[model samples]
Target: MSSRNLPDDKKLIDLQRFQLLVNAITDYAIYMLDTDGRVVSWNAGAQKFKGYTSEEIIGQHFSQFLTPEDQKAGIPALALQTAETEGRYETEGWRVRKDGSYFWANVIIDAIRENGRLLGFAKITRDITDRRKAEEALRLSEQQFRLLVQGVTDYAIYMLDKEGNVSNWNAGAQRIKGYRQEEVVGTHFSRFYTDEDQQDGVPQRALLTARTEGRFEQEGWRVRNDGSKFRAHVVIDPIYNAINEFVGYAKVTRDITEKYKAAIALKQTEQALQQAQKMETIGKLTGGIAHDFNNLLQIISGNLQLLSAEIAGNQRAEKRVTNALAGVRRGAKLASYLLSFGRRQALDPKVVNIGRFVLEMEDMLQRSLGETIEVETILADDLWNTFVDVAQVENALLNLAVNARDAMDSVGKLTIEISNAVLDENYARAHVEVNAGEYVMLAVSDVGSGMPSEVVAQAFEPFFSTKPEGKGTGLGLSMVYGFVKQSGGHANIYSEPGYGTTVKLYFPRSTELENCVVIQTVENIVGGTETILVAEDDEQVRHTAIEMLTALGYKVLHADDAQSALAIIEAGVKIDLLFTDVVMPGPLRSPELARKARELLPDLAVLFTSGYTQNAIVHGGRLDAGVELLGKPYSREALARKIRSVITNSIQR
Candidate 1:
């Protein structure tokens, strides 16, 4: 079966069959070249790829198929020489067709030898233009995708291995996580998690969830390379290969610390607004009730005064009347406290330096707190002035001191500090009812029993107290809250279970210079003979007023409402003073009635009275300018003094 023993014709047939097989291939060009680099044989594939017939291509130089640049560089000659010397040569480059077009080709040259005699070379050329183009497009697409991921700066995009180790890091990852690519790659992804999260196995859970569910997303606290923490919104998507084989994870993290803080502030502001609205509703209801109750107390008090005068000679009867009057006075005090909590009490605000004002009340505060309590005052230099009622301020301070005394069991220190302050926009955003501006700050701190958070939250609510039953009215803090709000101020209380308490009151700064304080001397309670017109809506209150004025030796005329009083004035009644209730059930208001009565009589005096002003004669919680007002539930002596004072001032004017 060896080729040497076979017949020459059989060998010739076998060689012809081999040539036929090589020539039948259409993908690779098969051809042979002489030692001089000229083509000697060509196949059908050579003809098809080179755009020439075998007869036309035979005997042509193989360099004709090479590009001009390759020809000029002698690459074809070098290839032939290398193949003859080294037995083979292979390369890939652009080749020219017979029609002058170009195609990417894989060329291989093999040395053909005949037993010590040099022969031609065998060359194979494959047109791989499609495969080359596909490979190049794939490389370019990968490069572009890498560039896109690297250019982003807001989100930390990175890759993690299946075991949750950092595999690759982009520029965005470096920027957001504060780590360079070299610093993070090959490190555990858990390093980016906070210590608490890591201890809770959050990082491991995230990877497991993503691998099983395809994706995992969450928002939480994350740590940076520098150990600083931020609120991060994170997403992890399990990566897969073309065949759907699980590979790793693609992680994206966004720093949302500022956004998170803003959301929290918005929620707190909403809660504060709700609290303010609730307090406002309660205040309205309390004010209305106090108004009506004060009217009833005034009727009882006025009638008791008339009976006291009639039974003056009977000691026992006089003593009982005195006790009844004291009871009425207590009721009136209770109503006054309710009015304060409702912000309906009339205020006489004046521009004064709060530091000096606090100093003036130091002695009174000391006396009220007794010897067991230690009082201290810290006044800042150049303290700002505030417009407020001096009497109310004194009352507020006294109330705080007394509460502090009771809290400490009368054995603690009370500190009152006054200073100028400025509330910025940040503070205003956190406190919905507060405005950003200059303020006069008055802080009262006590080294006594401290309140918890729950107590502090309810401290401003009426009837919410921590003291034992009957030990407190529970309106002290509520009254302070309403007064501060009515004066366009803010109050804040800070306390802990065992750390004592501090209450800060911020009043709007006053730009006006301080005014001189007016001191009024007490006048004797003497009745006047001046004719007075009493206008009251309540029948019992009107009758009580008439009886009191009659005993005071005044000629009193009575009217049930403002319209009736106006009619009497229009009828030319000789009236020296018009004592009118502020709120009336008539079309004619007390202010309008007083205006018309003055028009009819130039020297007539007008004195307004009310249990609650109801904003009729009160504006900004203060009485109107040049208007005289007497609060309700007054004693017989107070009515006499106010009436005499109003008439005497009118006659002088």
Candidate 2:
């Protein structure tokens, strides 16, 4: 410790060199302490590291450099005890410097003894602040990661033993599996599987696969504690020790019920879109056929009307004419049904007072549903009026009544309620194609045997039926769905097994317009003559139309194609009406021809005819809102009447 204590000569030179080497090291505080614990020597390294000069700290007590807590805990005494008994002591502690700052230090004290007596202690202290900080940071980061994993409520994060036993569970696992940690830990992971899955040994296979292949991934039904099944995406990973020996497994399970539902919904939507496209195509085809057939019907009806007028009081002929008129009406109904399927059902939207509508349906519901079921109406007064096709809405209500009657087996209470609704952003976000606005809510509730969850899910899927074979067509709700959707509304169904079912239809509120009114045309109208242009692709129908028009006394010019018809018009043919089929060849159609012909002859009355009405030309069997058009399969009388009407309407316009 002192210069006088140094031995003389070359071996002492080696010791001096070693001391010089230690003093040059700034990372460690290499110094000497006296037998009584006083700091005897401080090297250049100690001075630089401990913020002290030899003059200031040489005679100070070594405990003075330790933190107060360490000193209070007798850490200095323990160091001295180790130096005495084991000849050295090593430890890490917070040690102070001359500047009153502290750092994490690794300290080693070695007892220096000679000739069976203790002279002093050699001490070495290294700054370990960076290592300590790094360890602390790593520990904190791990804690945060654990918290993040536990906080996930959408996924079940847990661990399993190598034998597929549950070893750990997080909050997320508890929330998803409906189990507390105490109820699930140490149990076999197979408990999460459905009965069928468990019987199939799926859980064992999953673990086996994970152990053999290092990982296993699957998606299927997983049971909850309450016995309900959820669609889940699961992954199991084999955890191994450093020697690659399997220790346990890490299993992550996510309840993908919403995601699965969304996927199914998307698939259904695609199918619906494809079906819609197909229906549109069919509509166009049927419409073309109907258009031609209609011209033929016009010819027949016109001649029959003329004959009926001329042969008045001939009972046999009169009876035949009445039968024909009745047949034509039935045919019109079939065409309308087809149009509804094509979403071309004519929509005559009006601002409807929903309360009044529901009230109006109650008597009909009572009569249709019978006395066994009580019909209740909860009509909210002054509810926002909705722009809707009232006749379609009434039909939809009747359809719902029939559905409820079937569900309830005709013996439960049916509630039809109308109320003002405010559809906010949340509702709009949850239901596609819905917007935030005021709506008129027409809710139908039934206390019945109720539908299964799956049935409720597909309640509005077209052609999806649960009724016994030959009992139902499954188009009732689909039509309701289409009608409501086309009217700018939303529909929702809620049902649970053995409870009841509630269906809500929301139609956007109309700011103006009022009560639905059916437009009336002349009933039992007779035939008339008008110069007409008949454009038809079918030869039989074209020839029939020409004969019918000529017989009816209309100077007729005929063309089989829209192009030829246009050429006739271009050549200054004085056609009073442009009568054409809706679907035509080339780039022109009945509607397009009418536009061109009307330009050529401004006073020309245009009439469109189609077998099965469609969106492009007709809506719900009526002409598109403002278009004066006629549907196909018309009788001779209807044809003549429609021509007269169109011509008369043209005059009025």
- Each prediction's total of clashing residue pairs, residues at least 3 apart in sequence or on different chains, is 0, 10
Residues 1-653, candidate 2: write the lDDT tens digits: 76556667866897889878987888778899998788988888788778988889888889988999888998888898889789999988788988899889999999998876999899998889999999989999989989998888888999888777788889989999999999999999898998899889898899889988988999999999998989999999989889988799999999998899789768766765876687678557555555555556655655565567677998998999878867666555544544555565657666778788778778887998899988988988678778776788888899888899888988989898889999998666455457899988998999887788888878776668888887877778877876787677888898887888899999988888675544445566454566788898877667767776677688888888899999999998687888887766677766778888888898888887655444566544344555765556665666777888778777766
Per-model TM-score versus the true fold: 0.85, 0.56
CA RMSD per model (angstroms): 4.0, 10.0
lDDT against the true structure, each candidate: 0.88, 0.79
Task: Return the top candidate by lDDT.
Answer: 1
Please estimate how well model 2 matches the true structure, expressed as its whole-model Cα lDDT.
Answer: 0.79
- Predicted structure 2, TM vs. truth: 0.56
In model 2, state the lDDT of residue 48.
Answer: 78
Clashing pairs in 1: none
TM-score of 1: 0.85
Count clashing residue pairs in model 1.
Answer: 0
